[model samples]
Target chain A: MRVLALLDGTPADPDAPLIRVDDLGLLRGDGVFETILVVGGEPRELGPHLDRLARSAAMLDMPEPDLAAFRRAVDLVLGTWSGGPEIAVKLVFTRGVEGGDGTPTGFALGMDISPKVIAQRAGGISAVTLERGIEPGLAERAPWLLLGAKSLSYAVNMAALREAERRGADEVVFTTSSGSVLEGPTSTLVLARGRTLTTPPSTLGILPGTTQAALFRAAERAGWSVEVAPVDVAELYPADGVFLVSSVRKITRVHTLDGKALPDSTGLHTVLDGLYESEY
Target chain B: MRVLALLDGTPADPDAPLIRVDDLGLLRGDGVFETILVVGGEPRELGPHLDRLARSAAMLDMPEPDLAAFRRAVDLVLGTWSGGPEIAVKLVFTRGVEGGDGTPTGFALGMDISPKVIAQRAGGISAVTLERGIEPGLAERAPWLLLGAKSLSYAVNMAALREAERRGADEVVFTTSSGSVLEGPTSTLVLARGRTLTTPPSTLGILPGTTQAALFRAAERAGWSVEVAPVDVAELYPADGVFLVSSVRKITRVHTLDGKALPDSTGLHTVLDGLYESEY
Candidate 1:
C-alpha cells in the first residue's frame, strides 16, 4: 500500500520519518482526523469533511488546519495513486511534538478501500449495542471532554469493535449509560420510521454526521421528513430500518442488532444508497 | 532528543519509518503506553510500570507484550542517552497495521525531563477542578470503555489540561459527573487529612497510580496512615493538603483548586519527598 504525507505543505515520502517520537498525537492521542471516500479520482463530500475537521480542531483548540494545504495534498495523492475508483483518503492534524509551539502536524494518506469493507456494506452488517458509559447530557456542559470532536483518541471505540468481533458481530452501536442510542465507532446511526428519517442529536455528545446531514437534505427533497431526536436503543429494534453511515462506508444496513434480526428494509436501503451516492 | 524503535525484538532506528500509516495506534489511537522516570541510568519502579503496561494491553485486548524485549529496549535507550540522573523513558505498543495479524508494534525512547517539571515538584502548582464527565462505577462494569487502563487515547485528558492552562492553572483534578473526585489528567489524586493520606479508588474509572502505590507503602513505613476511599471535589478545599502523584512527576502539591488556596502542608511534602526518593 502506497502512502503520502503533508508535513510541510507539499506531499512528501510516506516511507520517510514524518512524525517525531514525542508528537502528542502519537503519545497522548491529541489530534483530529477525517476519512473521505474518493471515487473516480473525486473526493466525496470534501467540503463537509473539511468543515468537520475544522470544527474538530476548533473544539480541541488546536490551530485551525491549512485547508488549502490539505486540498493540495489530497489532490496530489489522488492524482498519484493508480488503483482506485474507490480510495479512502484520511486527513489528520495532531498537536505536534509535546512542549513545542503547538503548531499542528497535518498529513493526508490515500488507500484503496478493502474488499471486506465493501462486501460488508453490500451484505449489510450485524451490530451489537455496547455501553458507551457516558451520561447523555454531560457533554453539552463540559465541552472540554471533547465529546463532539473527532479526536484521534479512539482506543475505546477500537476495543468495542474487538468485543463485537468476539461476540461474532461485525459492528457496534454505542449507547449511553442511560441506554440512548449514540453512534457507531466510525459511523453515525440513522433510523427510518415510516416516512421519516431520524438521527440522534450531536448535543448528546455524538459527532454530527456529515453524510447523515447530506442524506437528510436529500431525503427532505425526496418527500421524506427528517428529524434529529434522542433515540433509545429500543427504538432501533422496531424501526423500519437502521443504518451505520459514514463518509467511507457511505451507509451500511444493520441486519441484526445484538443478535436479533432487525426488520428487513432492502427497499429503504436502495433509496438511501442512491440518494447518498448522488447527493454527495 | 534521541529515540529507538523495537519493531521486532531489536532497537530499530527511530529516524527510519517504522510505523505504517494504517497502524491502529496512529489510525485509531488504539494502544497502551507507560512513562517511567530514569534516575542514575536505572528505570525507577520498572516492574510496576511493566505490570501496568501488561494490564493496559490486556484491557485493550491486544497481544500481551514481550516484557523481556521491552526490558532490553529500555536498557538500550538508557545506555545510549548520556545525560541524566533524571530522564523520561517512554514505552509504546500499538496493535500494528490494520488488516494484519494484530502483531504489536513496540518502541522505547529516552529524553530528559524538563526543568520546569522538576521545579514544579519543589515549587508546587495551582490546579483546578474539571469534570471528567464520567460516572464513578461505570468503568469497572464496562471494561471496553478502558477507563482504568492507561490507554493512549488521552485526548480528553490533554484538552482538560489545556483548559486548566487557559484558566491560568498548572494542572487539573478531574471530578466525575456526580462531583466525585476522580484523579488528575495524568496523576492520581492524593489528599491528606490529619495523619491519613487518602486517594480515590480506581473503581471510579481512574488509572491506578503506580507511584501512589509505592508512596502509600513508604508513607506507612514512615508512620503515616494510608487509605483508599471515594473523595468528593468538595473535600479537596478543606483537606490538610492535596497532591497529584505520578511516576514522572513524583508528587506535586496543589496550591489551589479553582482559584481557592488549599491549606499549606510543607511538612507533608517533605515527608513524602523523602519517602518517595528513598522508597524508589
Candidate 2:
C-alpha cells in the first residue's frame, strides 16, 4: 500500500498525476529528499532527517523548507497508511515550476518497505568498492560540487549501484580517488575493530549518517568506544566486522567484499542491534 | 506560447500535472534529456541530438528510448508552437515510475527562448572558472561516474552556475583539479588563438558538444584550423577570444574571464558566425 500527501496536509492520490511538465525537480533534478523508516506507524528519527533535509536545501541554496508543514504532511501520510508496521516515507522538496513564481513543490510519499531491505537485514549482503572519481579533500574546497548534500541528482549513485550489480554484487561502497573509503551509494560505511566502532567523518564530503550517529551515542553510554576518522579501503579486509547503516535499511552486515568471504560477527551484530532498538 | 507533447504525439496541457510523484526522474534524477534550438519551426541538428540522447541512455544502462516516438513528439510540439522565431525544445526521458512494470516516461516541451539567452548573445557574457573537482584522466577510468552522459542529474551544474552568479558572473567554466580547462556548466569551451579554434577533447569525460562539432566542421571547410586538445587555465589569458557554445544559447562570446577582459575577435566571430549559418 502507498499513500501520498501535499505539504499543506492534503491527501493526494498516489497513482494520479502529481507533477507538472515544467517542474525543475523533473527537468533538472533540482531538489532534495529524505527517506525515513516507520515502525508501528511512527516515523523514526524524524527530527534528524528533517534537519539533514534542511541542511541539504541550504547547501543547494534553495529556500528553506517549512518544517511545520512537512510535519503535517508526514502525519497525514501516517494517519492514512493502513499497511504493515514497517514503511518508508520519503519527503521531497523541489524548486518548483520553471516559469512560475518561486513557490516550491513539496510532497510526502509513504510505501511499504522493500523486501530487499528486509532480506539484506536478515541475511546480509555482498558489496564491491567503486572509485568515486574525486579527491577526498575536494569536498570542502569545492562547495559547488554539492558533495555532502543529499540532492536529488543521484544518477551517478544509481549508476554506481548498477555497476556493482553488473559485477554480481548487491551493493556498492564508494571510495575516493586516493583509495579512502567514503560511504555506500545509499548508506554509511561502519567498521568494527573489537571494542571500537569507527566511521569516516562527514568532513570527507560524505553524508553524516543519522542512524550511525544515534547508534554511536547509545553505544557510548553502553560502554563502547566510538570514533569518527578517515578509513582506507585496505582497512576493510582486516576489520573485525563491517556494516552499512541507513535509516530504512538499518544495519546490514557485509558478508563478502569482492567475493572474499568475511568472518562472521554474530556477537557484535546482536549487540549493535540491541543498541539501535533501545536508542530509538 | 509553450507546447507540450507526449512521446506518442499526443499534445498535453503544459500547466497541468504530467508526472507522478514516484517518477525516478523526479525522485532520483535517473533520466536523460536533450535541449535543441528551433529556428523557423525547424529543430537544429535533430539527428545528432537524438544520437547523443541514445548514447547518454546507454551510459546510464537505461532502456533505449524510442527515437521514432521522440521524433513524432518533437514534430507535434513544433506543429503546435505559436511562439516567436526562436524556441528551445527539450526532450526528457526518464526511468519511469518506481515499481511500475518498467515502463519509461517521456515528453517533449517547447518554450520561448529566455530573454537572458538573447541578451547574452547580443552583448556577450562575463564568466568565472570554477574547479570541477575531478581529475581530467578519470573520465575513461570511471564510467560509472557518468561523466560523458548528459543526464538529468544537473544539481551540481546548477550549483556551479549559482556560484558564478555569486561572483557577479553570468556563466561558469569548469576546470579540472589540476587546472585543466573542461567545459562550461551548460556549454562547451571554445578558445580562438589567431586562426586556430581549440576545445578540450570529449575524451576528458565531458559531453561531446554537438554545436561545437557542427561549428568546427564548418570552420575547417572555411579555411580555419581546429584542434581538440587539453586546454589549461593559463591558455585562456592569452587567447585571441573565448566563447561558450551550446544548442540553445548558440554562440555567446565571453567578454570577461575571471574579471579580466579578453582580447576582442570581431573578425573571427563574424567569420565563424557566417560559417555556422552556411553549414547549418
Instruction: Tell me the fnat of candidate 2.
Output: 0.91
How well is each residue in A1-280 modelled by candidate 1, as lDDT tens digits?
Answer: 5667584657676655556656778888889999988888888889989999999999999898889889888888887888858889899888887777877778888877888789988899999999887677788878899997999999998889988999999999999878899999999999999989999999989999988998988899989999999999989999999999988888889999999999998888999999877784
Q: What clash count does candidate 1 reach?
A: 0
Judged by whole-model lDDT over C-alpha atoms, candidate 1 comes out at 0.86
| Cα error of candidate 1 at position A68, Å | 0.8
Number of backbone-clashing residue pairs for each candidate, in the order shown: 0, 0
lDDT of 1 at B10: 67
lDDT of 2 by residue, B126-200 (tens): 999999876877888889999989999999999999999999999999999788999998999999987899999
**What TM-score describes the B chain of model 2?**
0.98
Best by lDDT: 2
DockQ of each: 0.63, 0.91
> Once model 2 is optimally superposed onto the true structure by TM-score, how far is the C-alpha of residue A246 displaced, in angstroms?
0.2
Per-candidate Cα lDDT values, in order, are: 0.86, 0.91
